[model samples]
Target: MQKPEEAYSIRVIPDVKIVNKGILHTENKIEGEEYRSYIFLNFERITNKGYEASPTIRDDTLYYVNTKRNSLVMQKEFGQPEELFKLGKISKYTFHDKGILVIGEDKTDKKSPFVASKLKYRFDSRGLLRSRLSLYLFSHGELRKVVSGDFDVTDVATNGKRIIISATKEGDDYGLGDLYEVDVETGELKRITKGEGTVVAVAMNEKGEVAYLGHREGKTPWSTAKVILPELGITYQCGKTCGNHVLSDLFDGVKDRLIFEGDVIVSPGQEGGEAHLYLLSDGKSQKMTDGKIVVRSFDYKEGKLVYTYSTPEKPVVLYYEGQTYDPNPDVKGLSPQRVEVNGIEGWAIISGENNPTILFIHGGPHTAYGYAYFIEFQYFARNGYNVIYSNPRGSQGYGEEFAKACVGDWGGKDMNDLLLFVEEVKRKYNLKGKIGVTGGSYGGFMTNWLVTQTNVFSAAISERGISNLVSMCGTSDIGFWFNAVESGVTDPWTEESQMKLMRMSPIYYVKNVKTPTMLIHGEEDYRCPIEQSEQFFIALKMNGVDTILVRYQQDSHEHARRGKPKNMRDRLERKLEWFDKYLKK
Candidate 1:
């Protein structure tokens, strides 16, 4: 095989800030020079499993959960990292002067695993076997269980006194729940906000001002959510007349203004048009960053902003003052052409003439392909393939209605959008040879469905895709609820609903698939599960169709994005080999 294409990966330098002068106003620390020389120093002494959720800064110390170990770690003065709490699957955490509060799954009960195994083969109620996470208080190196129950506490925020949390109760509409405030001492809980929408982020400033991002009950679920300041009794919306898709929570350092990252909606059915740093102050919002570039995860203090900025051709760079640090400087970049098909927006990046084109789809039927640098897309382009990706119906970044268009109609209109996209690109670019298709999760489902619906694709790769919706509903982590919500089938166990699910399943259409397809899945993938790919591979093999299945024993559904570096490379090499074997021939 051709030597692996240029190793292109994006790296983010977190917590890069410029030290401001306190009382000693030295000439060397001039604001202009400080901005220019604020070099991003690589502190190689400290490292941990990828920084979990957002790192909370308290008293000049940084604290964050480690996803790999599910532990809370603290880094003071860039010193050796200290493990504060060894928790499991910490979903959210808040640090205050009193102590640290964490919400995570309690794996203390070893019987939980045995119970899960016992209910593995059971019917729809198997969801009950799953472990329920709870809230805990970590103080003075001791962990105390504060709240333990059925609901999941997410987006935890505290203002030193009161803790504000987004509590998601099971069986709530769309599984979204309300925000509640809890007393730190009394442990009394009070519902602060009630709505049908899903709360994404929550934060409380030092002044006890609670700011949250969520869709109101009647608003479009996909529309940009305004920052709701309940304590201040004000709703802060972006200044852009166009809809703004907020991507992060209001920073905790909010003194006079609220700051966050989001994209201003430029057109209908568009995902991220141009991400910008937005500042809301004095009852109005203002765009803080350059409108042309994409800026994210910014921290503002004392009239200075530190953020990561990138363009389509440049990987993310930590920008503070005028200094810039590029983590992946050696990585090659590609400029993609923005293309629109039937009002659906996408991008096409071509490399080398007469190269086979691969249509890539993103997962999250809710997530959208934006104008950001994607290593995988660049990898494909570097490997002499034209990569075309788009956000069809059901993709976020678009308006609410467009995002919900495919909610109950997966593999229906979205599939048509994909077909039309392929047709448009083929005709627009002309001289089309063979085309390959691939994606993970929902995108994988689309790939499986596409190959069966039509033999247009010469080759296909379905990674962590769902083949049988009915079986998936019972197997996946969020299987039952997600399937029920996405398919609009409230009762998936009913005979009629089961038949409808089977009809929508790609397994039922596998017999019609003629294209050589390779199935890639992580064996430990609970979201889509290995069985989804297993069922598809078996059906294809039984029908004498060309197919192969590659399973990563140590990986999960997120292997492609978050797996070990070696495993990620192996998976990509496998994809390259599969496409080369079939499409190149």
Candidate 2:
């Protein structure tokens, strides 16, 4: 007997191409075009090692710190890629006219082949290994130490005389930080912000006005904008008062204007909707792009805007001067219908009538499902399955209160929201008895939790899920901080906290699960770890429930989304097969 044909092939899905800190390639041209078309440069391509950070350009030379090779490369005038220096485990870099500032950990101690850097290792009290990120300044073929400290810098911006950095100090609450200014001439460091949420994406205008994006307590999206003048100690909100828009990626535009992409939540209870470019000038805000299209990374120069645009049915394309360049033309397009389920928002991409319905949940618990292209969802839809997805409470893009509603109550209201969504979809489509469920990460946790809580669905697929929160707190990366914050536990060592974690975990109620389950995980996943799936698998086996576990060796926590091409394909095939055996039959 021969194996059955797979519904989707990885060959057609294009390689991952991301443009971070993109620079305008003025001299590049499209094939068969005589005129020079504006093209963006990608810092790194996704291969076996994964993509690197964005590149910083200075004086016709492009400089990028490759986290994969643990080195920095310089390309002068779009020539060839050349190795400039070896800086191990770099997290961020900034290019100056006089020198380059590189920040990373010194990871020459680890002996494991799977360990990418020393940052991957975790300490007992500090959770993940907290290495002192030293700052080095390279100038005139020489490297000099600028500063060395134990701070996790999120972003950095410079203004010739001063450097502004956003960082969270040791022992500070997670997702909350402060801003600091450093004088270059005297090495004088000054704390700027006074515990104002998680400050990120700092930018300075030519007139010395500073702007940043941050989120305060009880906020969902990072849309809070603050403008500060250090000389006067004056700070105020720059854009329109935050309502339904979640802002991201702040850039200094021409003449005291700031440009950013705002994900606007259109549906009442939905987490996200379409994203549009917005311009803030003179204390007023205006939408730049059409409200329907989604804009990713964009840069404005001399009134001309260069941006990458995509939609639910479109791949990422560069748009400028009546020319559009599609990076991945081979990937198939899809059309998902916008669904409003009892004041909640969702999307459905139905393939065939009477097909088995699968409800997909997104991860992040903080992240939202938007009107963008998702290859996996498209694959399932094309393979004769009704794919449904929704953004419940605790998801971003909605208001701050709605997003924070599920923070401390993890398997509580958010799970109720998902159950309501499934019931509404089943009733609307008349497919109550032929439904299935699947998700990854936090979504995976919810899948496991849902199956154990109820037996409504015929099949369940959980990937990289957290079955036991007590073990998860000690094993996964960032688990120490994340588990405490999400579970509302001030002390993990206490018995009360332990019991709270156990109550929220799915493994405690595994014996009640009747739906057939398939567990998928990456062997090297430090985020959730393979033990999570293993524990759940063992529980199901002991209960005599039908369950299968699939582990990918060469992948990590992000295997389903950003793992190797072959492993991603194999994981998807396993999911399709499991659902077919259970739901189709």
The best candidate by lDDT is 1
Q: Which ten residues in a row have the lowest lDDT in candidate 1?
A: 22-31
Best by TM-score: 1
Model 2 backbone overlap count: 0
TM-score of each: 0.81, 0.80
CA lDDT scores, all candidates in order: 0.66, 0.62
Q: Which runs of model 2 end up more than 4 angstroms from their true locations?
A: 1-57, 62-68, 77-82, 112-133, 170-175, 185-188, 218-271
lDDT of 2 by residue, 391-467 (tens): 78777666556666777787888888888987777677676447899988888999999998888789999998889
* TM-score (C-alpha, index-matched) for candidate 1: 0.81
The true-versus-predicted C-alpha distance at residue 380 of model 2, in Å, is 0.9
Candidate 1 residue 454 C-alpha distance from true site, Å: 1.1
Clashing pairs in 1: 35-322
